[model samples]
Target: MIKEITCISCPNGCEMSVEVVENKIIRVENNKCERGISFANEEIFNPQRMLCSTVKTSDPKNLRLPVRTDKVIPKNKIFEAMKCINNIVINKNIQMGEKIIENLLGLGVSIIASQSLKINSNNV
Candidate 1:
């Protein structure tokens, strides 16, 4: 079977055709660089993606805080990760890059604050 994919490892965004047989990559074609090969392999066998979303916050001024995984998590786990992220409520002001959840889903990736959020003084 031929699988078509666009490589995201670099700015080239090379569109490639990957031939797979029995779920194994047999060949990769039309890639601009070696990274495309790697991308194809990882995407075909064990795809991953960085998770970014918003979490609920106690401050009405900042009702939602942007958050993201420190590193890529399995693509298959995004919905599960979102479930865990959805259950979290940030009650205190958090700095950008601060850890929101440690070892999320035991995947060794922490969900971190993507932006600094402060409580509104009027709400205090």
Candidate 2:
């Protein structure tokens, strides 16, 4: 089977054709760089994506704290990861890049704060 895909691994966005047989990549064409080959292989076989979302916060000034996975995770597990993140509530101040959940879903990826959230005393 021939599949067409646009490469997002670089700025070129090269559109390429990939041939697959028995769930394995047979050939790739029209790719501008080596990264496109890697991208095609992973995208076709085991796709991954970085999860960016928000977690509830107790701070009145910042009701939602931005968070994201420190590394790309299996695409199939994104929903499960989101459910876990949604259940967490930050009860205190946190800094940007601080780890919120370590080894999320045992995928060796950590959920971290994308932005700092500090409780505002005036809001209390």
Candidate 3:
């Protein structure tokens, strides 16, 4: 079997091809670094996503903001993970790179604000 992927680990986005036998990767090509190799193996085995979406906040004027996790969660738990993210309200002044939820939903990934949300007086 053969699989193709664009490596997201680097800006090059090297177009890589993997040769698999019996569901196992036997060879890889077009990868200039280890990152590409790792990415390909993960994709060929357990594909995951670094979800990027907005969550509704408690503030009325600024009700929604972008958020993401420090690590990618299991693809099988995408819906469940989104549910957990959706239920959260970041009222607290989230700092840049602050860890909002540690190991969210036990996926071993922490949910965090992609951009800091400040506590402004506008929120009444």
The candidate maximizing TM-score is: 1
Candidate 3 lDDT: 0.81
Best by lDDT: 1
Models, CA RMSD each: 0.9, 1.4, 2.3
Candidate 3 Cα misplacement greater than 4 A, ranges: 119-123
Candidate 2 regions exceeding 4 Å error are 122-124
Residue-level lDDT for 17 in candidate 1: 99
TM-score of structure candidate 3: 0.78
Q: Please give, for residues 21-93, the per-residue lDDT of candidate 1 as tens digits.
A: 9988889999988889899999999999999999999898889999999999999999999999999999888
Clashes found in each candidate (C-alpha, N, C closer than 3 A): 0, 0, 0
| lDDT tens per residue, model 2, 1-124 | 9999999888899999999999999899999888989999998999899999999988787899999999999999999999999999998889999999999999999999999988876774
In angstroms, the error of model 2 at 73 is: 0.4
Error of 3 at 114 (Å): 2.3
Model 1 root mean square deviation, Cα atoms: 0.9
Instruction: Report the Cα lDDT for residue 117, model 2.
Output: 88
Q: Rank the candidates by TM-score, best first.
A: 1, 2, 3
Error of 1 at 25 (Å): 1.3
